[model samples]
Target: MDLYIFCRMVLQQKALILLVTVVVAALASAYAFLVRPEYQVSSVLRPAAINELDALNRSEIYQLPSGDALIKVGASLESYETRLGFFRANQKLFKNFERPGRTLEQSFEEFNYNSIKLVVPDAKNAGSLNAYIKLVMNYPEGVAGVAILNGFVQYAIESQRQQIAADMEVIVRNRLSELAGRLDSARSSYVTDKAAKIAKLTEEDNLKRAQLQDELKALRAQLKNQRADQIAQLNEAIGIAKSLGIQKPSTPSSLGGAGVQGSQPVMRTEVNNQQIPLYFMGVDALLAERAALLQRKSDDFTEARIAQIAKELQLLQANREVEVLNQRKNEDLFLSGVQPLRAEEVRLRNLNVDMSGLKLVTIDKKAIDPLGPVKPKKMLLIIIGIVFGLMLGLVAAFVRGTDQSRRENSSDTTLLPHSSIPAKKALLSNVEAL
Candidate 1:
């Protein structure tokens, strides 16, 4: 293993080494020319950054911008699923193209391991949120190789755009669906509450109307009795005047309760702790006139007093009905503001329109056919072969020399049979002389 001894052995076997080196050189030349070479084409792409997606995400569904999402998209372009999709989509193209085997699956696998490659830059090291994607493809030397990369460029760009757009739309729809459900619940609650309040108001108004009607009938009866009593009083006064032949009664007669009724006070209602008063001035005036007419006994006075009493009762009944309706009107709140929520529903529905047509990625550079083949390094291979061949030659020489020395030491005769004994001895003598 020492340098001097090894050098001596190699020099002694220089002829064998030269032959092996020449043979290796010829083989390497053949390989360089005969083996098929591969041509590579590459395309650069710019993926949508998280910020870019966020800008397009009007629904605010995505949590944040993610460089990793872009990176994954790039990586998926090289995946089996995506490649299979390309193959299936371009079945006509694949049918006409050269394949390694009969099945499309075989051809697809060949393209997967050997032809297609992805070079996605690490976003973490790039000091940028978005990293660019590069795709490299190596194909067997032919025009088809160029076409393959060209087609792939389109497939990748289109697929990535579609993928990103679809993802965004899905997220938007999910967010919209949640919002829609919540809005529906709120609307339902509003509608139910409005209906309940309206029903309660109607019932309360009905009760108030019934109570007012009962009170009006009672007032009518009281007024009828008063009218009958007043008519009798007027008749009695007339009888006294006729019998005594006097123009006026000698005794000043009490007008019963007509004076008390003349001071007509309006009723006041209590609403939410506030008192609201309703006045009946017409009833007060009519009662005062009736009382003055009742003091006389003439025919005209009797007729006028009865007419005034009837008019006062009618006005009182009408005023009571108005008070009942006014109370119902004052307690309305729910139905007055019911349109705003409905308008919001309309707005949200319109906000959920189509957003599927957005573009998420753009192609920066397309794949182009390389001017020359990318593989088969002729000079480098030739150098390696020459070195390997010389080592083989040296090893062969050492083995042959060792076999010869063993034969000479172990055998009493020459290494050849007895017929070559003289020649073998002559060869040994020549070596000794040298």
Candidate 2:
């Protein structure tokens, strides 16, 4: 339609349009003020600082980095079970949500699905490590939005903290058990080796003692035979000296010079270049050596080897290594490898930390009561209502004006005079006028 005609139609129903606009606008205003509105309360969390996680990271048994801590906190916050648990624990805070038709679980589901939201850094972005996570709660008015938000945040953090502590405890306990097993194995191995070595030493000493005994016995027998042979030779020499009537030791030269008394004392040549025989030593010296040989008791001193064997046998009787090993009171002290394992065990045992105090996340912005409700944009709603009312009123006015004009035309036709003419001619005339 042309602007003039459209304006005329609108002005014709100005009162109706005004009333409709006022009613719609007033309804929107009332709804905005009277109905319960939802407020948005949020808390911003970031990864903990290096210093804040120092206690957990410094531990040898377990380590939790800042990024990992943040991830864990976020996971706990986003977990459905965790949110449901929180809702169940603090039902009083959500009492307004519960009514006759809605069950507690349904309310919690609505609350979890709609009211609560977790905003995290986009995974598509690479540098999201330093990004903070936002936990938002859209709670109705007078529902303690601030407390619910803060309380859930604290609950999620505490839940994650307990999980970490449980994990750390399990890790430390398993490690300690492993170390204990290793230590026991090492000690057992050490004892086994020591016992084997002692047994080997004892066996070797016994074998060596047997060998020395055999050698000693052989040497003593040899010395006894030599003494007996010496005695026999001395006795033979004594008999020879008695037959020759030589009681004292005599050189060969003296024998030649005194030969046969009356024989010619002519120049007798005496050449003694060879060693003298045992019989030439004389009957008295032979008899004395034979008597000394017969009186001898132990022949151990006769041979130098026998004395050496005796001394070695005495040494073998007391092996110093075996003695030291057997005399040890604490074998653990002697285990070299077991020391490091024990030290590690001690270190782990001393790391019995209280993770309750450990901080996981840093709160960048704490949840607080919002200044105004986020829902029910009053101005926008009021404007929409007015526009809708105006459009409806305009359509109604246009239909009414069209119907009035049609009625007036119908009445004008009825009042006009009726004249009879050729049907074809009248039809043509009417057609031409059209």
The global C-alpha lDDT for each of the candidates, from Candidate 1 onward, is 0.61, 0.83
Backbone clashes in model 1, listed as residue pairs: none
The TM-score values for the models, in the order shown, are: 0.60, 0.87
Clashing pairs in 2: none
Residue-wise C-alpha lDDT for candidate 2, range 16-123, written one tens digit per residue: 778877877787778877888889989999988889988788786567888788889999999998899899999999988787899889998888888988998777
Candidate 1 Cα misplacement greater than 4 A, ranges? 1-13, 47-69, 91-102, 122-124, 167-201, 227-248, 251-359, 362-365, 371-374, 404-434
How accurate locally is residue 62 in candidate 2, as Cα lDDT from 0 to 100? Answer: 68
Q: Candidate 2 — which residues are off by over 4 angstroms?
A: 1-5, 99-104, 123-130, 260-273, 295-297, 420-434
Superposition error at 194 for model 1 (Å): 5.9
